[model samples]
Target: MIGSSTGPLTPSRVLIVDLPGPDLTPDQGRLLRQSGFGGVCLFARNFSTEKRTARLVSDIRDALGPHALIATDQEGGAVLRRLDVPMPPSPLALGVLDSEDAAREAGRIAARGLLDLGINWNFAPCLDVNVNTANPVIGERSFGHDPETVARLGVAWALGSEEAGVMASVKHFPGHGDTSQDSHLTLPTVDKPRSELERTEWLPFRRAVQAGVGSVMTAHILYPALDPDAPATLSPAVLSGLLRLDWGYDGVIVTDATDMHAIADRYPAGAAAPLALSAGADTVLSCGHGDMETHTDHRQALLSALREGRLSEARVHGACARLDRAVNRFPGVPAPYTADQRSLDTAQVQRWAEQALTWVGIPPRLDPALPLLLIAPISAPVGGPYGDSLSGAHLATLLKEIYPHLHTVLHDDHDPTAALSLLDRFPGIPVLLATTGRWSLTELPRFLASRLRKEQRSALHLVLWNADQAAELKLPSLISHGFRPANLQALAQALMALR
Candidate 1:
């Protein structure tokens, strides 16, 4: 029946979909085998260890057929989906080196990690230019604020991934870096005109396209200049007219998760799926099917749109063709997956971390003989795919290995009770504050920092994670612009020298 007279049932338009869990359940297996399904996208929850995740990837491919594209957001730093091993330094860390070769080497290491796990598609090389300091997201994720620098680093990263036989998808096009809102929670608006985007925002994406990157993911934010009514993920003028026609990007056009509040708040999957496809998106990335009924309903909606002439056969076939072509460009990883540490040079990564780190006000000369108190905030906003709340605990553990006498306290900066408890317990000691992202000063961390200063105790703040959150926080500070193990290690070494 799948390959029968039914048209929509054959060669599904939706590409890079998600399963319910890590293992291939019966329902998921059937969905994978369905003619209307395209491929798979994995997340942190789907991974346990390197070898286990590799086995899971292999198992999915075996179930869905070898040609099925396996993809994940392997971008180093805060967006890494794989939890088994240490992620490479963030793109901003590489950008600090001002070396295209370093960016390429970092990209190669990231792609090779994915390839060894049998993944062929990596959603990485975030090309968003960090032009706005108040941007809620896309901070250290971006290479830098300069368009030329962003373009050069982005191209090197994309080229490196492709050269390593993995498809690199330059993302959040045309750009999501200038907005103050996060698309995952609300709809972020960019007021720039097409001319402005061409000058600043579009520079990195243009370079990646010219470099023969295999895919491009659309931004979920609204740009009135591009399309007044709809977001770019569902805008014909932006995706088809600009990206497909004018820019001539023949690679697969994947959408940011439609389930995200930016789109899902207004359009349900039944409606959003068809609109995205009609807007020239080659794939609708929907995570968590919810139930069999919901999945069936979504499939039927696309089929109905095609049959009723709402979405033509030509458009569906065109999308499918692009996906097939992208798939064919990159071969799958060899069998018997093993995460060999030799594949990545940890020493080189540490060296890069050291170069990328930036320090502002001088670190206080704390007594190395006395115990040091490290207070850190580690929580992500609701609904984000990345940003673990316990990330600081891991960083603290890594630091303790170097400074065995270091005392680490992990608490939510948003909770006054938690902050007060930690402050009351560790009074009079020189406290080191470590925070992750833009939300660092939201309520808890900001309150705690003020309280620490009012008490006239020695407090030194460090931007251990997202560097852009460094805006407006007047404190003697240090920043790594990344949270990887190597980055943490680099921070420890710097602290030791300051002591």
Candidate 2:
């Protein structure tokens, strides 16, 4: 603890760290007991059955103390971590519906689920105004392309979370939507001018702030218009000048993650953590696997910076106080947070999913008596930077639920050979090709396009996720805009109507 006659600045108070496993080890216990340690952010590995997660949450609270800030990236769609309920539709699906009620309902479900799990903070309501169709990281995760719609839906989402007693953090501050690169792998830069950002990318965040959201997560993308050199996570011009001074955002500011390649490529975790804190971030989120030595190194670096006056004690203290306040904002751990299958609003999720389906091309005249050949790529990844675990398998299951006898072929690779071979085998059958918008199916889209131009075979394209893919490929296709189980279920229902 770096203390004077005044209270000490414990570096751990501003550190939101994680562990590899579910249960707390002796080392984790020791670290949690440290006056500086603030909270724990959980991941997929920390969960199993809902009851198991409840027990794990109890254990974490016991080890870290009752008020330790427990958080997770429970931002529905494919980003769900440990929650045991059926996955909800993507934000894009909600954007398609453009219903404040639907968005609020989605937020309520996520927040209620997190609250039930003894987790208080939800890093969600991704407010990025997705302007670039080719953006790899924030595709379906974003609400939509229109800033006003994003703002309206984002505020509703936050309100729902707050109503459910979960602290909602509107994320990727300053926007991560316009860039094509993924910050997890590389540093992504946004060269848009300040005027353009204010008109488009910055609107949703301002709306979220005005709506009284308690926290904002900084993006790792660099905005030359806001700060020429550093990314928003480490840029004082953006965090301090733009968000704090200009926007009057007084709530806690959290960094996305210090270990992400966007920051790691330049500043190591130990160094980046302090830089972010000094720049205006109240807490540094380090979610990846790190050793005890690494954690110690991070703590020491902050302490050193404070001693050297590179970092202000007042700033550290202010951050610590804000973290404490945020932790207290969560309702005291109620009965063990358990998943209730009945509690999940499957109907609303279905509604959002159904609304998301946008059909293109002439209505296919298909005979139910004949086989409906469904050629869905086994898995076309599109959730986030590292890709998603969800695949065509989910779509297959949903389709089979409706059309049990439907002929299904799962394409594992991007090569179009397998799909072409399947087409040859099932000669005049109406083929419904499921893709994920982008070239996630690799060369399959190109091959299909060429084949479509050469011949007409009653083929109707269906994009399981990634609506932007349909436009980018210049193909007439139906789009689901999301890939979660609920979204797949809705798509299945829509296809059943076609049948």
Candidate 3:
């Protein structure tokens, strides 16, 4: 399929398409090769088994050869890419533990996991500032609130990634945090002043650049101060002036999924690809499989743009060179079919989870004779393909394991009456464990705060399993932050201590 072509096809200018799964059809592989695409980004849904995923990556390499780069969004916690294998705790969990060393270890674990699966690039260690709790997208994916904390953890993550021979990409450049809306659905605006941005939003990115992160992905959000007209992905001021010139980030600069509503809604499909490349992004990530017409149109448009002198050949070559350099620097390590004994054991995972759970606040233990009330939410909002709802069920299972006899109340955060009724039923109960679900304190209604404060006399325990919401709340009552089911023991210990 990828025979020599004298026409408009060029490898440097084209990076297209994300398949639905690890098993790529021969036709799909052929199409990619013929289109002159330079890479593919993998997600959890794309992988069902590690061995199959490894074979898939190998197949892709054979089809596209050395020029094709393989990447995945494998940041741990809820955003794990390899669904077949176990993933480490999320960045916020590491942040809560306040241990850079742990973060580094997580990075090593994650990197090793990726390498074992033949994945060379990981879109990880999000550099966004989690200032907005109501933000639908980047809650738990972010490290923490303080820019310094994010920067420190991000550096550790990057170092750990490099140590394990995986290229790390610090993403949503210019920051995706501080926005309440999801960029995948709409173009969110960040109205912060340049000074505020420098202090908070840009801090972690600066650290990532210094840490030698191999890539930086641009956000689709618009910043009026930086570019009044275009989103960061299409803004020359953001990519060239700030990221490249000011920050001196010589690494590959990639655009987030071009198919997202943030970009798709704003520009014509034919125009988006060329505009993104001209704006300074070396690669454009096309996420979904929508219409064949759209793909063909974009490809032709890019080729046409290059021929007409709208998109420079030099720019495309420069981008390709950066990507090639990154690939060569961190070449793919063949998959290790055998699992490492240390990583597969659940004890180490439980230990890490227990240590991370310490950051959460636990109410004093009440009389053992009194029945304890555990309020759990049925569903929660989440980013990517997975929603926050699944994690809630997982937590419920964990809680049941710890306190089999405890009276458990389930409610939907959407229903105010449900929460009120639960509150009324459990007045002055020494131990009231409320699962805020994935929603953070900031995302919660002000009425909920008033209600919680009114019942302040009652020992209230809050646990944030979602990173985005947890980082947003910065809740004084936060009791635990981890991804493992065993973290419930720490929560139980903290609750008992309250008594």
Candidate 4:
């Protein structure tokens, strides 16, 4: 427990670090430890194989010691951290199955996978109730549009983490699903009344608290009804008064990536740390800009703010206590954190992928004999090893194998214009298989629908391989839970049925 402090305090608990990637160096770890940062987040970019990732994690742990918190954004589907390893279907995919057992199993698989890699903290089980289809960030990364559904699945995911001796961080507190803008580049404001938020946005978070989630991540979006002046990450009323006081969440409170333009673009990095602390965030995730110079400067600024009495020492200690408790609870036993390849040999992945594809709706009569165009956007460049290149290529290859005679054309571009260009080649074609990268088809060219309508295609088979895109394109499309090669058989089957 953290004791109350009447005066200023030092900056001892700050979760300032970036997602480890190919670019991360051993010297960076030493500098982070020396700078008094709390932990580092891992991305697929830092890992090519399970064994290599495990070794990297072990190295980071050895350098940071037991007090440091090593975390990752392993929320499955579009946000998965470990691409080389086997993971369960995305939350939306699970939502289609609508089985609590499946959701729990997904949590278990995810937890075990992370634990094997020496990751103690997971920024996952996004509790944001995705009410808006246009929501650029949350989209299919969320469980579903319904709060109750999100809560049920979120609890299952959290429980799995705790059972596996890993800490689960339920994220984007107060909800971020309704906003149309991306918080990464702008500050999204929720205009809904407090009552609406209570009913929809805050429902999943409340359930997460009841389920005893180990951590909660604050959203950068501003809610006018809650606090017009500041975003949730810097608002005491939103974090302390609502999340802590009213909701009674005793676990660690972490801020979303502070380097995101939503927060960073608005406030000075130095000024935001203390404000976040005072607002009840126990950990501050800084996954972007991992330079030692920026880290040191930010650290000093936070420390000086505490020393100068701008921020309360009690809040700092309170945050540190929660972080310390989390670190202490991490499983210390060493296990094989590397992927063995054999572990992913199970038929369950194939079954689930097929099930998800079916739930997304592929036309019943997809002619395997006809030429099929597999159109999907290129995964974001910043996604590292988990980018669309790996998953996209895997899916394309799988489709080719499943439909040996099916003529396939692969386009990596995400722009609607690019898709339109490809569509021109298949004028008047009745069958089409489309997957819109990470972005939704709704956000794509409205003319695509016009072209489809003009083509009078009744057998258009569209599939969203990305969950975030799946949530927005509800036009009877098939969804691949995760973009794995295992989904190829299902895609082929669905396409063949379209005949």
Candidate 5:
């Protein structure tokens, strides 16, 4: 009964949704056909390889219709959906390198990779400025700690993506950077006063709008200065008043997955979908749907709202019209990246990593010819849809080839005993690397770093993706600002170069 009655426009058309896996199963195809969503957002679960992603996107087009828009986070930093491919470095790395041209090139490279995969939209250039050290989600994903730097590089990236025929969306509007909590887990509050927000948080978003970004995704966090009662997604002041009316962002305003705990724990999807649209969001993104039936609830609610006058006919039509405009503006193009282009892009990223990488205090001495024990602390995966315990299966294999006499082990941060055991057996000055997010850091990991230094044993503390943790680890640390394969390769080469 999800598609039982057809109006001039289906209620589901305003929904941007995601299915369960990589390929489109027959049932999923039927669901896509029945739902007729405006777009499909791909997750790491769906995209592993370019060929597979292209095939899956082709299948989605068939099911959702030829003109259906496809998008992914594909941010190239911590949130890349493509498991294996030549991708650009983190925004922080680019920011540290401090070249607007290179930032633009990185954008084009990432977009072209997605274009080859049949994805038309990229939710990238995470505009969230990483000013707060305790912020868990938007660390290296952000371009820098400064708003001006974020605005400059973010706009450049958006234009680069546009240059390659891909739509770019600047995200977490109003800003999710200063907040300490992750919205995926719970509701976060950015309680800054209006004056401070105007100077800091609002600058990049303002720049993005002036630059004509095709879409803007709203954060789930509550901004008391903007709207006290509701988070940005459900607040009319944030979406309609601030974004649409004042800022003049005529493009589509998409909500970050409402199924995330920030919105989910408070408002049910059925209620949130209609509420978001009424609040001014043109598209409601739902990614955690278990199956077609869950999506059906959102459709039913919107239909109910329309019937009850809770949602106006004009609003539904307006959203559909905007979606149609985006489809026309940024159509899907399955253009492939050539072999030569891949090689050049990879080398460019490697060069950036080499340039941006820096050392703290005296460098730890190690023999390139001697055995090396690398102790990396990675935490348990955050459960549910975004559940992730970062292990690439091939990382160890890749490191083994590059670092001579290298023994890399990704141990749970909670167990220092296991780390000590590994150190005892290896009989080498360990390279203590913390590659996980700050939220996942345990007391034990901090203790291990302190203990290694206290023993007067020379150790190299390598902090990737979180530089704030590097300061806490004291001196003799190397900061990569990211942990992608390219970042790791650059780290290895840099370590070997130390005299």
Candidate 6:
């Protein structure tokens, strides 16, 4: 795209920054206008209420432009940032439902909600096939274990969002599902042969490119099968040679957040910024330590690289051109794309979620007469995505909606004495250990479940995400594969009807 007729290279055009707070200050607005920035990535801190979110978007649009891309990880399951708009079941839940129609509708629902908040990009339809149940980060974020299934549903979801006027991007490309570790914590490697990767990790992404997905986000993990040295985010073979040349993918390539320890601990903002762009990434996600100057540093990093000749001028132009094309293709509107909030079809979404409840081994049809005590893990929130946040008030409200009469004991694994002692009050009641599914896969619930079983009290697991791994615990478990209230509603409804 940098061939002959593209705009001049600029830092703002290729950087999607994260803000410190929900409100954009006057100084920040001035900086944005001056930089002529490309986009903003919203986080959980950005949305306290719909009114405030609307005002934030209004100010952002005023500072940047109507066409400036607004993106967020509203992937509709575990990683939903906005509570005001009810999201449909997660990707894995949709996969379990096995309905292309539902998956597409879910995407449409997610896009419409984001569009209402003036966001144009949904960094979603995680194309990773969840082959490894031990994987801490990917789990329910992925579609399923089957590559083709993931591809089919991912394409459906992508089209649903794109057709709704918000662009959907398939992410953590070349795959993050097989890795046992979280890339946010450290560098992870997918050590498999190229042939093995072809059948597994590469299949869904290849299908996404064929389906005309407008963008692909690179994983920070190393793929020694593809490149011996750098991770996918900074590997030319993975990005340019494999994705662009061999696969013929002509979409914008985005890097995972450079702030993550996988990259940040290794490379500085200035170095990683140029390296990522040079490696064929069209945009660098540099969500610096929650400040305007973090973005300012990254902007200067790219400009400095250009001045220093560390990065090619043509490469910068090309990246900017690809990003601009994507922006033009899926521009953010000034106001809500859908007329009414009812357009989200909450009932229909719930129906799909209901069908996603899956069982491992025999269905633990606990007697409805048994007193139920819900035991959940509690811990400080982890810094990156897919962490310990799900066991909080959101989980409680949803669990309450489904099982009104249920009692709960929130426990930290460090001191299970408080929770275990509470469990004694229930006597012979069945214990429902709710996890952030695998996100809260600490020993707390397992230990408590073992303790309950030892006491001859019945124990059943109602995992809120990653049903694929429920079999690992050898407990009669139900996996919703989604963390939303709708997901819990489905699991509760299934168990209730079973009796």
Best-fitting candidate, scored by lDDT: 5
Candidate 6 pairs with clashing backbones: none
* TM-score-superior candidate, 4 or 5: 5
Q: Residue-pair clashes per candidate, as listed? A: 1, 6, 13, 13, 0, 0
The sequence of per-residue lDDT tens digits that candidate 5 reaches over residues 279-300 is 9998898876556566777888
Candidate 6: list runs displaced more than 4 Å.
1-5, 334-344, 361-370, 378-383, 392-408, 418-427, 454-456
lDDT for 106 (candidate 3): 78
Alpha-carbon runs more than 4 Å astray in model 4 = 1-12, 23-26, 337-346, 359-364, 367-386, 389-396, 408-430, 440-449, 455-458, 466-476, 496-499
* Candidate 4 Cα lDDT to native: 0.69
Residue 152 shift from truth in candidate 5, angstroms: 0.4
User: Looking at model 5, which ten-residue stretch has the lowest summed lDDT?
Assistant: 384-393
Q: Which stretch of 10 consecutive residues in model 1 shows the poorest summed lDDT?
A: 1-10
Would you list the rank order by lDDT, best first?
Answer: 5, 6, 1, 2, 3, 4
Residue 122 lDDT (model 4):
85
lDDT of 1 at 485: 72
- By lDDT, is 3 or 4 better? 3
TM-score of 4: 0.86
Candidate with better TM-score, 5 vs 6: 5
What local lDDT does model 5 show for residue 230?
A: 96
lDDT score, residue 151, model 3?
A: 90
Native-to-model Cα distance after best TM-score fit, residue 131 in candidate 3, in Å: 3.0
In terms of TM-score, how similar is model 6 to the real structure? 0.90
Error of 6 at 236 (Å): 1.4
Q: Better model by lDDT, 1 or 4?
A: 1
